[model samples]
Target: MTVVQITLRKKRLGRSLAGDIVLFGLLALVGCFMALPLVFVISNAFKPINEILKFPPDFFVRNPTFTNFYDLYHLLAGSWVPLTRYIYNTFFIAFVGTAGHVIIASMAAYPLAKRKFPGKTFLFTVVVLSLMFSATVTQITNYMTMSWLGFLDTHWAVIIPAIGSSLGLYLMKQYMEQIPDALLEAAEVDGCSEFRIFWSIVMPVVKPAWLTLIIFSFQGLWGAGGAAGSMYIYSEQLKTIDYAFSQILSGGIIRTGPSMAATLLMLSVPILIFIISQSSVIQTMSTSGMKD
Candidate 1:
């Protein structure tokens, strides 16, 4: 309560406040920088074809119009494959693939995280190493495996491989490790079977991890157009909306307006999903490696 102590405390508080202000100001600047592309996409979608193709393209639209969306709708309506069919295929694959990835990855992760077993370290190590390899590196192997399994030209070719994604398994395992061993032991003592403990206890506790995994899996599947569709899907009706939209975008310079509209439509779903699940993702990341 002395004046010196009070003055010193006031100085410390002032410096801390200044630091926090600077930190938050920098974060805001960086956030806006990162958001520019998304804002540009939205702006371009509403722009007239003339603005889109102007000598020097403007970042924002001068005269926004719905003509682009109308053109896109009419073009899709006149396509050989029904627009609804394409939408259905995209949703089916994204949903099924994301669900499968979350379940299978969580199941695989549980044992690797909590159970002691032979080669457990090696197995987890392999999963970690696999993350270093890009999908393009395994493209040929996946194709051959899918062909051997008679999954070629089928939705299974995409869904099955995604279900076994190493990234999801790795993330789930890391999250599960933060669960206390005593908690699981208590569940076992209370007559909970291994599956029951996993489903009832572990899964609920690690919900944020799997929710984050769902976002990753869904985005990947939703955006997959060329690699899976061109290689594995031969039927137009079975092709995803992304593939259909991609075809529209490739229809030369005349289709610019509609292409921009299609681009916006395609980007909207994954962005919405991320926005909804982002809180869970932040929660998972914050405590990912910490133990109870």
Candidate 2:
């Protein structure tokens, strides 16, 4: 190559490298900013009360201790309802709601993705539009519907609504679209029922999407029970972990340290769920191979 071309190429490479460096630096700064509160929560959980409440509020713990966790345990043990009941309620809602949502969303998504039917396009468009609105916007109407169905104050109030989640439906339908139509056609040729094809074929192939949906549904339901839950569930024994944790945190200055520790404990489940599901999600994405 001529020296001019080589110099020009060198200049382009230098500018590109400079731009990338600037981009990553900015990203790193933003990442640190976003991570600061999480770091504070983790560190504060272990910090001695004096250190945590110290002037200027240090970012890192000067003296770490497990006393906060111990205190949190004692506090929970003193509750009228057993801690197990709260835990059970949380897991029941999270697991049952997530399972129902995944199955129902997948079933709805398959036909939307693969089949052509009258009003199918309009139905999907409505689902997409639903995503633009937040659940809180429909609170009054949802409450009336729940009351009408006699689902108020029951676990069904939470699980039933989750089954019709718009985001989950949208994501599953999009993922199902990537699955080969030829595969479904071949299965049909073998006289396989739609349910059989979905359960055995579409499900295994769309593992990533459903795993992702699991993480979303589980996390949401796990920490749910605020407005809707509080309104419906008046029975203390049926209250979720979130309600119990909120009570703990509201215990004022004396309980701040324990509340931080409790927050960490509460945060751990969803983080672990994401970590495990994320690995499977990545694996499924990498291994998904389809022929036209």
Candidate 3:
């Protein structure tokens, strides 16, 4: 190649190299952003109580110990956690709440998306209006309703109001809208009942949406109101992990190192679940359409 041609090629190569470096750097920055909290938690979990408040955080745990985990589980000589109980309560609440949300929300959404009925416009309008206010804004009323229903201080108390939420129904309706009408028709033509059509045909196509709801429900309940109000099994045995954590914190025993460790451990499961759930939540949301 001529000198000018060689110079031009060199210039292109330099640009390409610079572009790659910039792209990689941006990705690394994002990765660090995501990992920083997790890294801090992991390090703190291993440290002793004193190191957590050191002038500068002890970035490394000089002597790593699994004591935090044991203590949280009530497994050590001076144990505090009711580990198995918390695990059971959390999973039970999370699973039931999630499953119910998926079922009831999708059931509500299916009709909103596809079928027309009496007072349809009015009902939808009301739902839309309610969306303007969130759970926090309505907490007092919700708490009162739970009290009236004799569900207060019980697992059902938490579960009922959660299943009443519009968010999941809204999301499901958006997803159900993306399902072609012809598919429902085909299911009907094949001698399927409405229930079968919904169970076998409609539901299969909305797996991504279902997955999204599951993750959302799990994460939401694990941290917030999901496990907060259950009344059954009054003790460590009945309380959810979130509730247990709250109890610990409330007792004014915030072991910085162990608290950080326990918190990080508690946070890890949902993070992993979210990573697994992102694809579906994104896909279903991206494909869903809004109604007029």
Give the top-scoring candidate (TM-score).
1
| Regions of candidate 3 where Cα sits further than 4 Å from its true position | 1-25, 58-63, 74-82, 225-237, 249-254, 279-292
lDDT of 2 by residue, 131-200 (tens): 9988888777777988899998888888888887899999999999998889999999999998999999
Identify the superior model by lDDT, candidate 1 or candidate 2. 1
What TM-score would every model get versus the actual structure?
0.91, 0.87, 0.78
Query: lDDT per residue, candidate 3, 1-292, as tens digits?
Result: 8996899888887777678899999999999998887887788887766676677776778878877666655522233544675677677777788889889998888888888889877877777788899776887787788778887666766777778888888888877887788877877888999888888877877888889888888788777632353432344445676666655654444544456656886788888889888976677655653333
2 or 3, greater by lDDT: 2
- Computed on alpha carbons, the lDDT of every model, listed in order, comes to 0.91, 0.89, 0.73
Tens digits of per-residue lDDT, candidate 1, 1-292, equal: 9996899998887787678899999999999999999999999999999999997899989999999999999988999999999998999999999999999999999999999999999999999999999988988999999999999888889999899889999999998998999889999999999999999999988988899898999999998855688988998888998888888668899899999998899899999999999986687666654355
Local error of candidate 2 at residue 259 (angstroms): 1.0
Q: Compared to the true structure, candidate 1 yields what TM-score?
A: 0.91
Clashes, model 3:
4
Ranking by lDDT: 1, 2, 3
Residue 127, candidate 1: how far off, in angstroms?
1.3
Which stretches of model 2 miss by more than 4 angstroms?
Answer: 1-35
Clashing pairs in 1: none
What does the lDDT come to for candidate 2?
0.89
- What is the alpha-carbon lDDT for the whole of candidate 1? 0.91
